[model samples]
Target: MWIAESVTFGGSALDRAAPLRGDAPALADLQARGRIVPLWQGKPLIANGALAWVAPGSPVLAEATAPVFLGLEDGIGWFAQDISAWVPPEAEAVQPGFLDPSLQHHPSLPADHTFTELRAVMAQLSPRHAELAATARALLGWHQSHGFCAACGAASTMVMAGWQRSCPVCGAQHYPRTDPVVIMLVTRGNRLLLGRGTGWPEGMYSCLAGFVEPGETIEAAVRREVFEETGVQVDAVRYLASQPWPFPASLMLGCLAEATSDTITLDPAELEDALWLSREDLVQVRTGLHPCVKPARQGAIAHFLIENWLADRLN
Candidate 1:
């Protein structure tokens, strides 16, 4: 796991600048000279295969919500603003699917610069840009969903540079929440356990994954998820790498586990199908030559784990 940090969305060494979160003067100064990443409906604006940054007073940001201070690099500040309120002249109806392939364009931005889904271009972005996009998406999504205080029914106000929300009625402060999920690469000798959820694309299968329940350790979560999903008993679970999955804010904890039992008793509610693939079969899947299985998403931790396992780098 020496190369663990190299996983997508995990390796940007961006300086978060925690202390400056509460300093109004400092943040104001940074905002005046910083670059901003505009997001629409959770999609970051992209141009030339990278994050397209705009100035603070860009016309595209006229309808933007409060900006979140992302951090600084090379003495220049980076921020993210949500312009989800702006309606496109001819907005495409929102598609009901896992990943939205539609792109949005603001009149102020160049024609080449479009608001794109992060998953569609995550692999193409540099480490720094990927990290920034993930952070902004997750934080903004949290704000949208958690507008009301949990402790009280009163609405909350953004504070701490978009990192926290304060409830005036109850004097309660809430921070962005990230749920932990364990995605395991369960192996028995030369075969790996794979499962396909309901509604997944045909021929698509990936490492079994589930959320870490309350009071459960990472090891326990891995074992439980594998057993619950496929009736496979796992032992000797070890940490692999992690990915920040921001579909709605999840920290995917990747793990490698040895399967003691190969029998699959599928939970109809959890998975549509479960099976094991030998290393040779997996190789074919990765290369798009397998008849029954498609490769995992390229920028996902499942793909990272499988690629490393194929190369015998899972030590």
Candidate 2:
């Protein structure tokens, strides 16, 4: 909680410049000196541990069709484009993966440039890069998924500089929506509760999380999720930090809670297993000495909470 803003995808604030998003003339003027960040297949170009954030008139922007205005910084406009639809030129065939030794160049940019998955290189990026990448992914993914108006089933047009979609026939407007998920750090005495989803990687465990239902509060959601996932009743829920998890769109509301009772009830449909890990157990996992139950990976709120708990920083 003390290091709340240090969480990967939530704390960093990207100036959206919402009003300017609707100003075509102002946007165009800014475009003359603005920078564009292109996303291909949900990944961004990373050169020397930074986003390309190409300047106006770059080859990348020239090839991009109808980019979304991201926001502004220092009077310079920022925009984003999803070029996943663009077909790449021919290249030497190789295995497709980050592990492949050879570099994969951008289809439009120079041969030295390459695109990498944000998650794979997020830790290497600055706080701003992570924030912008999350913003772009969420906005673009929303556009990709919501192509029609839910109210009238009419085709929608991108408007508000990518902040909204409008259906001309119905006069309906749709904005990007983020689903709220409650992730709790439930503790009883010196032990913390962690659960592994049914399909999670072996040895991987994290805090209990579930989407907040309609008409539910964050505190209630945390209590309900912890109880439903592991049959552990918790009370006195307190907010911690949050993260923007845009693997299609989610806002993780991290919280800390006090368990009223310790009881294990496996929701087979929700979790593969649930267990209580003490500080020593967590230390072993952190040290890679535990036989199973690896700590949540860095950059995740679960890991952030656990690390802070270990350091007596969570308040």
Tens digits of per-residue lDDT for model 2, 166-201: 999999999999999998889999999999986677
lDDT of 1 by residue, 81-158 (tens): 999999876765345687888888888889999999899999999999999999999999999999999998799999
Clashes of 1: 0
Candidate 2 runs further than 4 Å off: 61-65, 88-104
What is the TM-score of candidate 2? 0.91
lDDT for 293 in candidate 2 is: 82
- lDDT computed for candidate 2: 0.82
Which pairs of residues collide in model 2? Answer: none
Return the lDDT, model 2, position 21. 81
What is candidate 2's CA lDDT for residue 218? Answer: 96
lDDT of 1 at 282: 92
Clashes of each: 0, 0
The most accurate candidate by lDDT is: 1
